[model samples]
Target chain A: MRIVASALVLSIPILTAAEAARGETLTVTLSHHQVRITSTYTGAELAVFGVIGRDGATAPRSGDYDLVVTARGPRANTVLREKRPFGPVWLNDAQVKFYDLPVTMAVLSSRPLDEIADVDLRRRYAVGLDTTRASNIAPPGAAVREEEFREALIRLKTQSNLYVQDERGVSFIAENVFRATVPLPATAPPGAYEVEAALFRGGVRLAVTQTSFEVTKTGLEQFLAREARERGLLYGAAASALALVFGWLATVVFRRD
Target chain B: MEFYLPIAEMPVHVGLVLAMSAAVGFISGMFGIGGGFLMTPLLIFIGIPPAVAVASVAPQIAAASTTGVLAHWRRRALDLRLGLVLLAGGVVGTLLGVLFFNAMRRVGRLEPIITLSYAALLGTIGGFMLVESVRAVLRARNGAVVDPRRRPRPRWFGLPFRMRFPQSKVHMSVIPPLAVAAAVGFVGAVLGIGGGFLVVPALIYLFRIPTAVVVGTSLFQILFTAIAATLFHAATNHSVDLILAMLLMFGGVFGAQFGAQAGKSLKGDSFRLLLALILLATAARFVLDMVVEPREPFSIMLSEVLP
Candidate 1:
């Protein structure tokens, strides 16, 4: 399942429409369009190959090019909780709801994100772990400590391997060709993931393009998950019956009578 | 080997899960009890979601109880009438427990509530068992016999709806057994235990059920209650991972046979003492977790309001 998506260079932020019309265009080819998760599925490395093409009027650059490939999983609502000391114990005290949170996110770049772009630019483009934004739906009259929660969310996600970063994952193979390896951990949630590639030179964005892939459960994993979600009652009954059979069989096999 | 759990949405080391279940199963088999009290927490500790851990263990508990239930039924050691009454109350309790579990999850307080409940229940029950077993051991050493017939009846014995259990040769108010079973069922459903440890003592001491039928009757109730709990968890929470449960059931059933063989050599009081210590140790672990400042003060969860 190779999916090669070539995009016409689009003007994004600093890049002008006229410049994008004649400047570099980004084309990306994914090793797999769909990652199927079976019982034995562990983790996968998705190879992203890209070519930087220039139109006739485009000027050649003296310096090398920088590429960043980011893959963001499906958005979901998330809760962040902070534990506070209470009566000799700590418990979850404060919480904030974050809407449209990415279940899994990975950043694969030619260089450290900080070196590629300044903090403000990175934040604007969502080029790194800290730059990804998930809006908090604060309750009315509540003063939300959003920065702390956001940092905590990123930290937790990183710990779980759901959020990842590879500073030198992208490598230039030729003058106009580059490749990036997106490491998807086994814990990555199954859903549609948007993969974006951005081309930069001397801290100035030249082009941006996006592609999509899906992570899906296959075979028994697919069947069971679907049954559990769609026919919960029947799934539960089946589980009980299965357990009973196991129990009965155990007794029979071990029977000393 | 690693296996991905669909409902849990995580990959677990197959060997680790199996060994854990086997260890817990061995203890349960040695003590003639359901091992869910130990299993759910272990699953959570190994990074399975708390709700998933609790729900998935329900079927495992049912499977573990089945062997005892069948054996007791064949021997006619179980009081079917009493077991029915307990199951009736247990069904109600399991329903309420599932509803409460859902509500707690929505509020993001499910983890705290489950931890607190385990600490409290395990601590109290373990302490009682420890003291009783110690006294029993001392009495045995002194060659003293405690007469059960001379024991004073509790005040609650006068409650309404008296019923006769011919197998156990006991006549008592049905309300007591109903209340006890309901409490056990509610705790079991929420905690993912069969509640055999709690039921055995309550039936023996509270209702004066004969020791001969107590284990059999309690196993009967536990088996059905666990079935109900498993059904509710699967249907409502959708957190029961069938693969994980299957692993647990296989390990538990296989390990129990070996454990039963070893248990035959230990004296009853000493065995009870060992079981009590295990319970206390588990309770202490929960307490320690609660009181200790976590390395990471913040946690994240999927919000109930999914987009």
Candidate 2:
């Protein structure tokens, strides 16, 4: 309650400041900035609320307000491979290397992205799933049909629920206030995520705002990840010893009288 | 009911994982075999990544094999000298296998190679088991008796470095047994199995070990091989998921006990027939997967970020 109240308080000042400046601006506030992963963690739904403050003189019709929100997980290199028939068996044939691709991505828009902005603008802002693929480059010397590989990556990621785009995800709660829910799947890796919200008028981007949050493992997950990465040899030895002890214990406890 | 696995980075139903492991454990206990051939595929079918599934299953096999070894030890069904020879060969073979595994992964050929190898290996082994067991069953029904002493001598008997195995009643070159053990260990490391099914048959037919000691000695070797595999996979690939292994082992330990008790009442021929059917079924599944069209032809893997 206190966090929400404080966020609302902070949002008001930004809203009034934008009105005084007589220009279009966006102010975004997230419900929570830190997501903790625990033993019981399945998934999480994060609420993103923002206000699009615009000068009264340039205010569009009530129904013309457009807001698009995008959340991207940490960037990393990825390999995408396609299996093709070889003789009688299928083998991986075509491969593509993508650099600096977001591990997870979620895009939410009040309306269809095409209706809000043109193709060029959408591509520039990565406002839609199709446009997001345009930014990924194929590795040199690889005969990678960029279009096919990019589509495959999108399809696979979408099936895993790591990449999502919802046309009606964002909703206008008031004339200038909007909110959207971003669903993070259980398979999402821990990382820093950047949430970007953009405001547009007449197919022109007016103002954009970005905020970041962190997803971190806690408790057993934290300890295990740390051990596996930092002290790998020790972790392996401990794991083997634990298994040995457990097996011995089970034999002792379950022995027939 | 669901628990998040840290290394696998996924949430799986506790009951589902336990039930699957228990089923595999029961089969392993009844047959005196390590259950990785069944368990690894089941784990992949249930949405765990194949790499993670393969690596994590090693520790579970180690635990189950230890229990099996203890039980056999109590019955005095073990030949320590022969087992040590196999273990020495197994350690060397596993090191080579781990290097091969890492190399295949680096070239992005690991998934396809692993799948194809499973299909080929399972198909041949299952086919042989099914045929041999059926022949044994038929011969028993017909009351045909054959004297073991009259059988033709194996050609490998003339090799150098002769060693006597008093428990198995065999006097032969150590080269054949060591070579067989090394080959089985290599496959075991690559396939994430204890190789008990393979080793048991090799001991009985190749080394001509007594049937009583074969199971115990195979388990003893498997325990060490599995431990080596788990450590190598963790140190090199960091693919060993301890939480997943523990969950599987938790159910396996109890399940093996019950399975062992139940196996006492089963007839030998019928037991062999049942195991043969299971092996065939698992092999058939892999063959079908290879021949059939996949729903998605493409897969994505995150590459490590260079420092």
Cα lDDT tens digits, model 2, B1-307, are: 9899999888899999999888877776666778888899899888898888988888888887777777667767678778898988887777777677777778875766676787677667767767766887788789975323336769797799988877667788888888888887777667556677777667765666655577668778878877887887789888888899999888776676566656556655555567667767877776776677777888875554322
Which run of 10 residues does model 1 chain B get worst, by summed lDDT? B298-307
Worst 10 residues of 2 chain A by lDDT: A1-10
Alpha-carbon shift of residue A101 in model 2 (angstroms): 0.9
lDDT of 1: 0.78
Steric collisions counted per model = 0, 0
lDDT of 2 by residue, A1-257 (tens): 01222344245446443754767778888878898889998978788888877676764565777889999887778889777886666776667877778888999999899989999989887887877653454556445478888888888889889899998999987887888888888888888989999888679888888998888999999999889878877888987897788778777887774
Report the Cα RMSD per candidate. 4.6, 3.4
User: First chain of model 2: TM-score?
Assistant: 0.90
Model 1 chain A worst lDDT window (10 residues): A8-17
> Which DockQ values do the candidates obtain, in the order shown?
0.57, 0.57
